[model samples]
Target: MTKPRTILVLGGARSGKSRHAQALAEAMTPEGCFIATAQAWDDEMRDRIARHQADRDERWTTVEAPLALADAIAEHSRSDRVLLVDCLTLWLTNMLLGEADLAAAGDALVAALEDAPCPVVLVSNEVGFGIVPDNALARRFRDAQGTLNQRLARVCDATDLVVAGLPLRLSGEK
Candidate 1:
């Protein structure tokens, strides 16, 4: 059997990172699980969630892990299937808003990835590239997101940075 692998996809908003991650997971298996971290807080968010939901067909099972991402990963991982985690930034936002310990949560997520028995594709926005935020909360979130992305990149077997709908491999083989 092929060994399980973990891939981290990073990009700015509208950079096609989620779609790239989905494609990567789909290429690896006929059936997969999509672990969605987005929570519909408003109508716009609900529409975004719906669009994402519509992207996948019957071959995929959707799991919402708005906060309990590590648990979701652990529970859904299987040798015969792949897992696509679309956007960790949203997950981070949820953690911050919920007042969860960021460091502990990041550690748990990395540990889960290490122990997963299936290939996993993770999406995260590369937020550090832009100018520093004006507000304290925004700056804090950007910092946390940068740190989390760095940690995940360290653990992933491969890392890809998507730009303008193009993927550039940052580390490891394709």
Candidate 2:
């Protein structure tokens, strides 16, 4: 089956969202770029990045776009290749911590997705499953994440929720 132009893959931590995105990209095309939105601010994070890098084979080109995700998508996206954006949640966090305007960034990202010539698969954590946080910052982050996810889902041609490596299509077709 032909993949949709825009796909939003949402899941909890370790719910295999990224893996599912990777599989989607690979299924679309053997040659594609994996746009990672993770910043290695610590040793553990650096190790995690390394492990993720090792997991994907050499057929993929990896690009790290922690802040300028829209620019990265615009630069690397094309009709002949698939673009896998792994985890928008980290990108959102990076934007929030960097004090960037969330609405502006998200708008730009949405524009980019709309204009993208290739299949764009985006991974993000579904933040509404957990209990309400006690801290204000945590709550703020949750709210921002929820808003971003909803906005992206609305723009995406298809939306999937991954749980324990199984994907349930929330919108569009399975």
Candidate 3:
């Protein structure tokens, strides 16, 4: 059986999205690299990062790309390596906080995934379902996140939504 070239997994926090993405990447191939986009800003974040790293075994190559996701994806993606980008929302947060160009970075990410030589799995949060935030920055983030998710989903070969630890195929078959 053939595997999907690109997949986008969307869910909330603790919704098993990253776990599911990691499993999918592991199943696709033995040589897998996890591209983490999170930055450890505090002790709690460092602990969280460590916990996520502990989940991986020896077969995983972990790369930390807190800002340059497109460059990391382009550099690591190859025929023998399956790429997994865990949590695009965090990358977006990083971009926003760093005052980077969100639109250009998002476009570059889309292009990188489109041209990847290996299969790619992207994980992101679905942050548009709840009540709107009262602050401007929060609202901007929600809007940008929704736009990015929709954009990535359009180009991906498959899209899934994890609800309560259950993955429901939103586009292609699992």
Candidate 4:
């Protein structure tokens, strides 16, 4: 059996990681599934979500899975398809604020990636490059997200960091 290809894209906000991931998926697969991990809890976020939705063409099938990302991957991944997760930061935020176990969720997600029958592309924000927050929750969130990104990168077949809209391939690219 052929090994499934997995790519992890990391960057700061508006660093073009999502767009880059989308392009990679579109180029690599005939059918693609976009697993959106964002939940619009406010008007600003709602507009941001809408803009992202509007940016894509109708060729992509989208699944709004705010927390159950592993299940979404297992359900949608196929041998001939590509699964692109738009953002993991929101998912992490949801997990952290809801008191879900980040380590458990990360393990589940990694396991799903290992068993997935299709190519998978994951996008996440790089949160550790900024100044340290002054509160406990903020510090914990930053730490968790950074750890999550590092874990995913280790398991991914390819990893890229986006800086100022430019992609710097860090590992597993020929």
Among these predictions, the greatest lDDT belongs to 1
Assess each prediction's global lDDT (C-alpha) against the native: 0.92, 0.89, 0.91, 0.89
Model 3, 27-127: lDDT tens digits are 88888999999888999889988988899868889899999999999899878878999889999999998999889988999999988899999999999
Better candidate number, 1 or 2, judged by lDDT:
1
Q: Which clashing pairs does model 3 show?
A: none
In candidate 4, how many clashes are counted?
0
Poorly placed runs, candidate 4 (over 4 Å): 1-4
| Model 1, C-alpha of 5: deviation from truth (Å) | 1.1
Report lDDT (Cα) of residue 100, candidate 4.
Answer: 99
Candidate 2, residues 43-157: lDDT per residue as tens digits? 9889988987887879889999999999999999878889999879999999999999989998999999998898999999988778999998889889989999999999998
What are the per-residue Cα lDDT tens digits for candidate 1 across 93-150?
Answer: 9999999999999999999999998999999999987888899999999999999999
Colliding pairs, model 4? none
